[model samples]
Target: MGLPKRDQQYHTYADYLGWPESVRYELLDGVAFMMAGSDLAHQDIVGEVFAQLRNALQGKPCRPFVAPFDVRLPKPRQSDEQTDTVVQPDVMVVCDPAKIDRRGIRGAPDLIVEVLSPSTAGHDQVLKRRAYERAGVQEFWLVHPTDRVVTIYTLGQDGYGKPEIQELVGTTPVGVLENVEITWDELVARLPKIEY
Candidate 1:
């Protein structure tokens, strides 16, 4: 699917807050990108990933949140109107309690997961990845539902290091989070079978 037409005027978090909640969007460098609804497979993967993260984070300080949760990436000392970027990752694990508020996350999350959808794959892989890296997200995962593969990126001194690829065959340890393992085969088995 194609992206929404570019608006002439740049948008801010204040403007985003006032927009209708029925429609979903993300602001990147003051530009708005409309978000498309996820399909069954995408939703299933998101749910499973969230469940796994949630289970691992149980009794821990870090917490997992699904999409539609605002993650405002603001510059230091910037107000809501001055803040331009606001994104909603498929699943985010925020370790800082201070960042959690009535609105949403105020800064970068510890880990972000973006499950690929046909409409938003490009943005997720390129634009969002760069933005997340710039915002200092520690770990980023790009999950391809159709291919049943996951590409993990870890932030380093220079930026994100080489991506570590993992196929959805067996259990794989989540590198960023200690002792956390995702049962890939179980997740794939539980996904709803779709016929084209």
Candidate 2:
């Protein structure tokens, strides 16, 4: 019912530029994957995380970004035409202003937060996680709305070490942002309750 599989060729940033502006997609290793729409719970978590990061980054050099903001991850010395990875993280923080441009972020953000959705859980947890680690993202947070938990990964000399797990019932400081703390209870309180 859609385009032929044969026509679905490996895509690059140049090809990404030609897609319909209304739809959202991510290019991972030259393969284009359509992005799924976010549910209310997913959006709520993203908003809360973004708000917390935005508040903490006020007056600081680092800035926070929400989804639909393209993050082009190009390999060393590769041109945009030769590069092929692009992702729109649920929430991202970038300290280097030089990386921001008219198209989007040209490099990896300092921190990336992904709010899990059933359709995207695997991609976010595995493929994207490995990609972020490879891109040298300093910190990564996987927020699970259903489980009400947040798993944090911090990169070290070797790579990302074991994750720090925290439930969404207490305050936890962001590992990458100094003096930034998020009160999970407050965030949880604002979320809609699910009735079993």
Candidate 3:
């Protein structure tokens, strides 16, 4: 379902920019894929984690953001017209002020967190994972709310290396950002228990 393109044709940032704001989509390799609405659990998890990051990043250089914010990944030497890939990470932390353009992030963020769901497991784990790696996103975290676990990938000279998996509880370090971690005990308690 995640691979559902609006139409079977290549699209670009220029085309994406012209679309109505009411409807949201992301361009991957010039392919326009519709973004689905977040369910209650997904929104709750993203909200809580973002809240945590916001508090932790206070007075810090890095800033946290939730989705619907564009992250344009332009291939090397490609201009805006030639650039294709653009995505909205669920939660992102941008440390560079220059990347924080008026429209959205012009480059990769320091850290990107994606809350996974049944509808998006494959796409996030596979498609978006590769995209983030290629774009040099320093760190990528996939928060599996259902399984209560997190999988992190840190970009390296060879791109991303092996993933580091951690339980979505207690004090788990944000590897890319020093002295920052997610203490999930309180956050977990706040989340409503629901059967998927």
Q: Write the per-residue lDDT of candidate 2 for residues 98-151, one digit (tens) a residue.
A: 999998898889999999877888888888898899889999999988888999
TM-score of each: 0.95, 0.92, 0.95
Off by over 4 Å in 1: 190-192
Q: What are the runs in model 3 whose C-alpha is more than 4 Å off?
A: 190-192
Q: What is the C-alpha RMSD of each candidate to the true structure, in Å?
A: 1.5, 3.0, 1.3
Instruction: Please give, for residues 111-160, the per-residue lDDT of candidate 3 as tens digits.
Output: 99999988888888988999999989999999988888899999989988
* Clashes by residue pair, model 2: none
C-alpha lDDT values of all predictions: 0.88, 0.86, 0.87
Task: State the displacement of the C-alpha of residue 51, model 1, in Å, after optimal TM-score superposition.
Answer: 1.0
lDDT of candidate 1 over 24-125, digit per residue (tens)? 889988989988788888888899889988988999998999998999998778786789999999999998999999999989999999999888888899
User: Pairing residues by index, what is the TM-score of model 3?
Assistant: 0.95
